[model samples]
Target: MKTDSLSAKAKTRIKRPPSEVFAAFADADLMSKFWFTRRDKGLKEGETVKWYVGSDDGAFAFDVLVKELRKPERIVIEWMGQDGNPARVVWTFEESEQGDTILTVEESGYAGSNDAIVERALDSTGGFNQVVVAAKALVEHGVEVNVVADHVP
Candidate 1:
């Protein structure tokens, strides 16, 4: 069998500590405020979480398998992409000397036609970028930018 894959990466520096930034992703409630519309539970290693977007009629849902979780540092998860390909997403949090956290998101394992792989990778990059930006706004200024929701509708 032939194997083809693509990956996307995005990074952002938030004016907050690593712990705070990490919590923004680990906790379901906090994440809902910035990213996903709703998450069934907090992220934990070896656990599965359901995330939903939009209302009941038009809602899109997906299951994320938490592959790894390191508090204030890193997290890895696997989920099915829009194209039905298994994708792995990694989040890394690094604390800088200026008392800020640099968060990086990498997603890989898009397998399909060249065009489909490229499209998925590009979309993942933009989505992750919006996630981090929304997280920064929520964490630093206590404001929800609603970037995730904005992208949906």
Candidate 2:
């Protein structure tokens, strides 16, 4: 079913500089405030870090290997997603002349039938939408809407 060809992308324009916007995703500590509840370390090239989400009682952990890390621009990571299958996620930041940044997140790879893969991609798209929205709120306005955290039980 060409799982390799199925990728989900979500993008948003944040009312902040690229570096500031990128920090929310590249720095583990800063990331906790906007998205993904916690992480072991910041995103760095060739490094693998453990990231956590959900509440204390419902914590979900995943190992992410930073494939590429370009400050204020892009990040690429591979993690065990899609029911333990490896998936790649890329984050890109394009700064506008007015100091704002356009942020994009793309995730690909999975194991399943065509329908299952399509379903997963759709779910990832929605989840990424929540991620970017919450990130914008947190970074631009210092508000945690919990858009990602509140989605699950």
Candidate 3:
């Protein structure tokens, strides 16, 4: 697989409407069901929200800056990357042929040495891959995959 890159994208078809899928992301409580364990607040334009994640080791938190928000359509946010660099994540919601939501997530701004950048990019790509799949299970089947938490072990 191609590794060395500054950005990565993951797309998935969710058997739900755009609004429902969007709520899975925009609403902090719903997001905890699939991705981060919890957050300080829901997403809002011009605001930075703290997202806490759980793992076998313990829990850690990160800040996600909501750069843009467009209801059941799109959202853009910037999260901290290497040494204060900001990595941008853009999530888009599209209506599919069956009236379901086509969710797309793209993250960029991987920075550092050649190997460092590639490693970070690969992790981000893989992480997002797991996230969307977990989200699909929760939103479509109401199953908590515990994906991110189980990533290490």
Candidate 4:
């Protein structure tokens, strides 16, 4: 895939250490508290996890297979739709100069120049940004940031 075709990048800095920030993704409980809408199996290298989005109405879902798991650094996973084409998510954790951790989530591999792909990318960017902020608030100040309140006008 051409790099130029990729969508815009979203970056967020969390006021937590690398381990804490990384654990926010790897730990199922922590992830459910911040990112994932529901709980599933624990995250490990070479494990396949499935989770749904909506509650009772049966909405969109994703089946992700863990590809790479580098502790406190990076996690790479393949996000496939029900049809199983090709979607990807790369989560990276970096140590900042001020002793904070920067988490960068890069997702790509949407089919072609489909308008739906653009919408999905934008929605994912907003969700990830909110999750990062929530994780930061939880880890640093022991408070959870309500993203829906912030996102909704």
Clash count, one per candidate: 0, 0, 0, 0
Extract clashing residue pairs from model 3: none
Q: Score candidate 1 by lDDT.
A: 0.86
What's the ranking of the predictions by TM-score, best on top? Answer: 1, 2, 3, 4
Per-residue alpha-carbon lDDT of candidate 1 for residues 89-135, written as tens digits (9 for 90 to 100): 99999999998999999999888888888888888888888888899
The alpha-carbon deviation from the true structure for residue 116 of candidate 2, after best TM-score superposition, in angstroms, is: 1.6
Report the lDDT tens digits of candidate 4 across residue range 29-68.
6665655544565677898886545333464556778999
| Local accuracy of candidate 3 as per-residue lDDT tens digits, 1-153 | 333457877999999999999998898788887788765567889997877767334578788889999999999999997467678899999999899999999998776677777777778889899989998998999998877667783
Error of 1 at 47 (Å): 0.8
Clashing pairs in 2: none
TM-score of each: 0.91, 0.90, 0.88, 0.78
Index of the highest-lDDT prediction? 1
What are the runs in model 2 whose C-alpha is more than 4 Å off? 1-3, 55-58
The weakest ten consecutive residues by lDDT in model 4 span 1-10
Cα error, residue 141 of model 2, in Å, equals 0.6
- Cα TM-score of candidate 1: 0.91
lDDT of 2 by residue, 1-153 (tens): 567599889999999999998899887777887677664667779988877776585587778898999998999999887477788999999988888999999998776778878888988998899899988998999997776567772
lDDT of each: 0.86, 0.84, 0.84, 0.71
